[model samples]
Structure formats: structure tokens, C-alpha cells
Target: AEIAGEYLKKGSQVYVEGRIRTRKYQDKDGNERYSTEIIGDRMQMLGARAGSGEPREPAAAKGEAKPAPAKKPAGKFDDLEDDIPF
Candidate 1:
């Protein structure tokens, strides 16, 4: 499960290769307990990352359309002066 979890995300698809194994152990009450799990050997991501509705375009296809830089608000601390107790 750990191997498969690494590739899992919202809206993403994953392929896992593994085998099921069962084991027995003693419980807190001294009763025999059994648990079964898949021991994954490999995992593969099948699609784009989560929250990105569409697949990303190749850098070459993007041409000269670069993303705009984040703009800070005018007068960095002008709005915070009134909120500070000090």
C-alpha cells in the first residue's frame, strides 16, 4: 500500500504491481488475529498531477507565453499597521 500511495492523488490514476499476503498475530486479548494485505513491488503514475484539470503542454509548444510574475500589493505594510498591537 505504501508504494501505491505515493503515486495516488486526487484525479490521478495509478497502476500497482503486487501480491497478496496474509499473516497471523496475537491480539491484545491473547486471541489469534489475521490480516491480509498487498505487498506492492512497483507502482506507476498513469496521468497528470491532481488539481490540474488538463495535462501540461510541452515547453516547446508554449512558445513565448511565459506566466506573469506575482505582483505585491502597493505599500507593503500600509494595511497591516492598524492590525498590529505593538
Candidate 2:
């Protein structure tokens, strides 16, 4: 609520991860209208910030390295035992 109310402008580009629903309702004039609502579980603001010219990036793509599992090998035979006869 705070982010949308304070940070987002009328044309702010955002990526929303959520379920969307489209419902049909009648207006006061008895005219049919379709409304789409997004229930965003996750939302990200795209493009530059309020004043910054440079575009922003997601946290994972911003050079944050995730430590891989210790047991993972670089190659198929990388884990071969030294005592293997084959």
C-alpha cells in the first residue's frame, strides 16, 4: 500500500507476479463493463527510479552470487573415484 501510494506514478512500469481476475459488471446505466484486477503476490517497479536515469535491475541479476551445493560437480566425470578400475 505504501509503495503504490508513494512511489508509483500514473505511468510507472511494473512487473506483477500474481493471479488476475476479469469480471463483468453492470454500470449505473445498465451497461456491461469488464474489469480486470490483479492480486499481486510479488511486484517489482521497473525502469529508472524517481530521479535516477540508469535503469534498475533485479536483485539476482545485480551480480549477487548464490553459493552452489558443495557436492555439485563441474563435469560428468569430475566425481569419479581415484580407485575406479574402469
Candidate 3:
């Protein structure tokens, strides 16, 4: 909740690492319901905080929990126009 309450703004970018979890529950009406959520084990802010260039670090919920260090993206990027034939 700390991360969401703090850095997760409408346009803020974020990187999340975690697992998908689906659970069954009931709402106010007591009707059966299902919720699928990403249980973010670690989350990192994508860019710098507003009005500053220093990037914000991740916030950890677990004990002794500090945010994960800034790391390179695990995914690969494809060449955009470089591979295109003119």
C-alpha cells in the first residue's frame, strides 16, 4: 500500500515484479465473486519523481524490506526502423 499511496499516480510509470493470484470471495451483497490480482513482491518506480531528476526507489512491504535496487529491464527491445527495408 505504501507504494500505491505514495508514487502510483494517474500518469506515473511503474515496474512491478510478482505473481498473479486469483481468489474467490463475496462482496457486500454476499454474492460469489472472484478477484484476480498481481501480488507484487517488488515494485520500482520507472522515472524520477516530479520536479526532480533523482529516481525514486522501490518500497518493500516485507520486513527488513527495502525497495529493490534499480536494475536493467529483463525484456529485450526490437530494432524499430533499423530492420525495415526502404
- The clash number for model 1 is 0
| Native-structure RMSD, model 1 | 13.1
TM-score of each: 0.45, 0.48, 0.45
Q: CA shift at 58, candidate 1, in angstroms?
A: 17
Q: Point out where model 1 deviates above 4 Å.
A: 1-7, 49-86
Give the candidate order by descending TM-score.
2, 3, 1
Write model 1 residue lDDT over 14-36, tens digit each, in one string: 66678999999999999999999
Candidate 2 CA-lDDT value: 0.81
Q: What lDDT would each prediction earn against the true structure?
A: 0.69, 0.81, 0.78
- Candidates in order: C-alpha RMSD to true structure: 13.1, 7.9, 9.6
What is the C-alpha lDDT profile of model 2 across 1-86, one tens digit per residue? 68877989999888877899999999999999999997888778888887888898755535669767889547667666789677
lDDT of 1 at 43: 61
Worst 10 residues of 3 by lDDT: 73-82
Give lDDT: candidate 3, residue 59. Answer: 62
lDDT, candidate 2, at 10: 92
